[model samples]
Target: MTLGALMLVEYLRKDMVAHGKIGLTMALYSTWNRGSSYPRDKVIGLLGIIEPRNSFKPEYSWTVEKVYRVAMRAAIAEDGNLNCLGLISEKKQSRNKNLASWVPDFELHSEPFRDYITSLSKVLNKWSIYKAFMIPGGSPDITTDEDDSVLILKGFCLDSVSVVGTQAPGPDFESVGETDPELWRSSTRDALNQWRSLLPPNDIYLTGETQAMAFWRTVLVDLNQGRLASKKGGRPKRLDKSDLQDLLQLETTDGMEGLLSTWESCLRPIYRQLRLIEQFNRRFFRTESGYMGLGPPDIQPGDAICLLLGGSVAYALRKSAHETWTYVGECYVHGIMDGEAAVKAVEDKSDFTEYRLV
Candidate 1:
């Protein structure tokens, strides 16, 4: 069976019992492939499934942009968090310029990280490991503009993108029935090399991690083949000393050819993880303050990385006009993923700023 079909069946047996809120239902539905020809069906098609209906109604006359905006507003109101923003992707944003930057286009496919972002189990827990926001019981302090196209959020800009690396190779680089690994190896090697060159040689990040260590960790977004390994009867584990030892060889080797010749077997797992991250269509970047991260494919050197109130992860935003920011997409920055930035802000008495996302 297709993966989407299996996910549907699993949702029917498991998720359906737990998910009754509009936000959760919308997040779940975003993972599925809707076959409707009408654009409004993206939201209208799932009205029957969202239980205890608050204000969502079938309005065929509404524009697709309005439908998406209303659905996003209701989802955020019901959930009381900005988790829905995780579903926004550059691919989806590029499809419809009229849609609000804060509102996600449910019609397009998003990244796998959406599952972790929109998870309800992680909502109430403030002290969870690896969470970006540290404020306890924090909820989104949000408002809308006159036309509701602009979403005003309370948060502080953490850092600005100073350097961005090449876009990772897509799945087609290793096409079906292609046995040769040279093309894939060369492309991946070049990308990693470019990312490595962007950092200062022999310098340590603000988090006190070596540049080499942070580079590998950021490339994989600090995850061990979690979701991919679960299907193969293996539990996901965090990156450990042994994993780092194997990955650090990228620095010692002369090039991809030299690396492959000696430690190919030892680095197999690391390579697999890299391929998976590449499939997500991400780019490796660095902030002005020496923070390394994996951001959306469209992330640029001038983009602002912010931590919005009640957000589980960091976001990449671009300045559009005077004091207005456009949502780039979700991001994974090292060091600050577990609330380090938020804690420091409190200690330093840095006031949170209001961001108007359009």
Candidate 2:
């Protein structure tokens, strides 16, 4: 076991530097290719990045202990609403066109390393214990024999409720002439309303790209240091951004106006990347009330945004059967998603028992 661990570590060090520090998956791994032996960053990065492929096998050379090592490497990627959860590869491998959602799609390509994700997810599903859940699919529940192998987890999901895609002001706002500011203004307002429809009218919306939160961090990081309050409080003491602050001072209108202003301030950052908008809306967002946040790959009818113990945000999974589930995508749920609701779930003894990834 010790020798195996050493070999795996040495192999991964080369893998880490060779791949520019990008995370590794079991599928991507080849025992024969030990990777570069130099340019070591001494950092394995987050375990979430590696897709646990199955090309590596047990008895021959790979063991369950090796699988645990892979998951341990990913264990560091802990976030409540991680911006990169449920992340899949845009470049699909032509042959790997048929995955039944058994694995968490955290790879850069559709064809996971030899379906290792299936086996890896099973291990993680077991290790997750209380927080285990299946993606929306069919996989018979099976148990891993620890005596035959070591059990470990790569990543887990968080309890979330909704997904909020970008609400970047439309092209009209960008190209609209200043001659009729009201036209541009009205168009922008209409867009804001459409964005609002993605989430609940009454519930709060927690976004992923948070420059606002980062800005507040500068102010309170020193003030509170390690105070849990700073970590748990909601709405960052009245939206500290200067422009939004000034707008609020001028007009304290509630309802849509306040919502619009807040929504507008969030546009530039959320819309920072044109590519991410679709993924966030379709794959990452879900809720019980309807597909709020981002849509099109709309939230399915029975989808529930759940939080796993070590996850960044709530992950949406569809219950295909009484206990069978398949991963939908990452999500940014409002209210309970401010890194507190999941804790409350634990306090309430809401331990999960339905995860069975094949």
Candidate 3:
């Protein structure tokens, strides 16, 4: 391995130690093969062993081995960023509250415990059902409002497309608890087969891997500590089929071709929006809210601009009837928005739409 690759592998090894063997390295690059150009952010992201502030060091001062050593130490330390322990500690100390209890059973916002579980369940269900999608990557981003209410945002879309059909099937389990061992084995295989068949023939899906699990755990710890009511039985709530329906954006198809076309149309806008959001988050680096990266508006707050790629979307897969994250992976085949070349990308992809920040 090159110095950079060695540094990265060591960094990931440290994270695995810190995060209790959970797969937290999806934030690292999986796109390239052995000798391709490295993605710098992913390497830095994996180096969560170092403080984000101290991640990149002066090239002249530190040798490759020294940097790797330092990163590994950071990953295993008490305050390491590689895992949720520190975050859990912070959650325990915080005085904020959870708003999940206020969410209603009939409403998507109601029954906060069930709500979160339901969303998670759908992801699990998708993983079980879809054979073509790769496992989910990175982590889910969870936040809260000023009112102490929680907002759980999980990012999944076209990114999980590659491993579909290629993954060796995992061992199956029957129900969470099964009395008959033989029946359980058979049921497990049946379940796996059912999952493989339910997915669309050629579409992409999410896998909700280890990093996503860690993210969910942290968010749950935060929620439990916050103002939300604890469950009566002290057990994590389970979401059933009906509850699952409320969280997904499954389309009622008029037909297959139309459905595909509509989904394709809706993708560009969502991709643009997510790119802007990621850029804004990186630039500001805030724990909470602020106007996106464009700076405060001269007329109002910050002058906000929306860059529309490929004109207006031909159609949107999930309509904006409610506040929901619309994920469109694989849209940016060439580049992302964080680099120095971002301006060029915008110019090449679409016209930048300047708008008033509301």
What global local distance difference test value does model 3 have? Answer: 0.23
lDDT tens readout by residue for model 2, 66-114: 4333332333232111222233222223212333342222322222121
Which model, 2 or 3, shows the larger lDDT? 2
- What's the candidate order when arranged by decreasing TM-score? 1, 2, 3
Candidate that would win on lDDT:
1
Off by over 4 Å in 2: 1-85, 89-97, 102-192, 197-298
Candidate 2 whole-model C-alpha lDDT, 0 to 1: 0.33
Model 2 — TM-score against the truth? 0.40
Tens-place lDDT digits, model 1, residues 1-358: 5443444455454444555333444444544444456777767877656564655654898888988887777666666666667556436535687888888766653333222222211232212325676347656676777656788887788999999889865433222233235655667677777887888765687788788878877776665532333453222345667767776665665634554433232223223322223223578898888888888788999899998876767888899888789888878888888788988887898899988988
Lowest lDDT 10-mer window, candidate 2?
Answer: 117-126
The 0-to-1 C-alpha lDDT of every candidate, in the order given, reads: 0.64, 0.33, 0.23
Give the per-residue lDDT digits (tens) of candidate 3, residues 14-39: 55666554232222222112222322
TM-score of 1: 0.79
Per-model root-mean-square deviation over C-alphas:
5.5, 13.6, 21.6
Evaluated at residue 337, the lDDT of candidate 1 is: 81
